[model samples]
Target: MSRTESVDKGHGRIEVRQYRLSTDIDWLRELHPEWKNLGSIVAIDSERLIGDTTT
Candidate 1:
């Protein structure tokens, strides 16, 4: 299942959208070193998140 989530900072700051991946992300490591952290994913679900632009 695919999910989207948003990360919020304080003071109406920049917003971050987060998308949850259902499948194992190990295959993504080759493309994104950040994917290495995929193994730490403990839970995930379908979510959609929206945030403000950072400026």
Candidate 2:
């Protein structure tokens, strides 16, 4: 498990961002050969801090 975080203040809004990923699937390419040489896929999940949200 690994993670990093940051906080940004702008446009009268405060944003706290946390990012995470894994070393849990090193055998990804071996299992899925069709996706040759790909180290990682960018998967992002985002939401509104104060309003509604979506993934």
Candidate 3:
């Protein structure tokens, strides 16, 4: 597993993003063989804050 993150602040707003990756998907490949040569999985998470609101 690996992770990375980024943040940006501008125009009175702040944005944050996170990324994750994993190559331990052998079980997934075994369960679903249709995904040929599947090597890795990735995910992204994000958040934003503007003024007094967060989403």
The number of the candidate with the highest TM-score is 3
Instruction: List, residue by residue over 1-55, the lDDT tens digit for candidate 2.
Output: 6677776657555567677766566578779988775756443344335334322
Q: Write the per-residue lDDT of candidate 3 for residues 18-41, one digit (tens) a residue.
A: 999999999999999998699999
**Model 1 ranges with Cα > 4 A deviation:** 24-55
The TM-scores of all predictions, comma-separated, are 0.28, 0.52, 0.89
CA lDDT for candidate 1? 0.54
Q: So what's the TM-score on candidate 2?
A: 0.52
1-55 in candidate 1: lDDT tens per residue? Answer: 5666766666645455656555565666778886666653434333323353333
Better of 2 and 3 by TM-score: 3
Candidate 1 C-alpha error for residue 55, in Å: 6.8
**Model 2 root-mean-square deviation:** 3.6
